[model samples]
Target: FAGIGDPERFFRSLRAGGIDVARTRPFADHHMFSREEIAALAADALREQLTLVTTEKDLARLRGSEGVPDDIVPFAVELEFDEPAKLRQLISDHLYKARERRFNTR
Candidate 1:
């Protein structure tokens, strides 16, 4: 979650999706957890009764590495656009205007 840009954004999306997480564990972007670190975090999670949740990219990389806990899970994130039709129309208008200007200049 924190491995992705804006850890808060990931939490916001999780809440929007109705995943009621009480707290977060943040990691630096593109962080690779060592064997000892993974073991320590996994033990802490077990002690705290918390699940290890992370972004898909982190899970992917972690899976590739040795000594990572198997319990760490990945969550998928999707961005939603507000007033998608209006945004599409605005983009279309901008593209048309730019095209007209380019053609007119020729």
Candidate 2:
């Protein structure tokens, strides 16, 4: 949780969800990391024995750069829709309407 948004919220969620985070470093949303900075952060994480877990969006932002250390793990948010059928129906309706309107132009 080291990119784009307050890491505190993530840490709080973790704690609430029963994760014991030793420490955290938050950065601006869509933060750009330099090779040197990444190296330092990686070293710190290893030295402190902290598991580096970040959002998938942040991992993607890194663009598979070698600067990103291997120990860093990508964390993904599980999307839980309240009503799957209703949500699916809404999406289907929106798509259907969009397609109908697009092709109806004569």
Candidate 3:
């Protein structure tokens, strides 16, 4: 999961649905993240051996900026059906295709 307006609601919904997602990164809505913030986040993700990602909304905010380093990865979260299982599968498929597209280019 990514930038959520309400963390409690998110957790509650997950609990109600019995979904077991391991990690969640939340950002302030339309957050203007600094270079230091991006670096720290990238370092933490690397330290944990986890994929580093961000939302398209956050990416849009960062556009026309020069401070962001090249290593950070931007991830976009798309909304589909409200059903949990369906949403999970859709996101998984999207990520897989996105990853393939990203890595296949030279």
Which residue pairs in model 1 clash with each other? none
Clashing pairs in 3: none
lDDT of 2 by residue, 1-106 (tens): 5776777777676677677778777888878888887887788888988888777788787768876777677766676888999999999999999999999995
Candidate 1 lDDT by residue in tens digits, 31-54? 766788778778888898988787
TM-score per candidate, in order?
0.67, 0.68, 0.46
- Least accurate stretch of 10 residues (summed lDDT) in model 1? 1-10
Question: By lDDT, who's the top model here?
Answer: 1
lDDT string for model 3 (1-106, tens) is 3454764555455545565545666666555677787777667777887665445556666666776655545543355666999878989999999999999996
Clashes of each: 0, 1, 0
lDDT of 3: 0.63
Candidates ranked by TM-score: 2, 1, 3
Off by over 4 Å in 1: 82-106
- Candidate 1 to truth, TM: 0.67
**Model 3 TM-score (2 dp):** 0.46
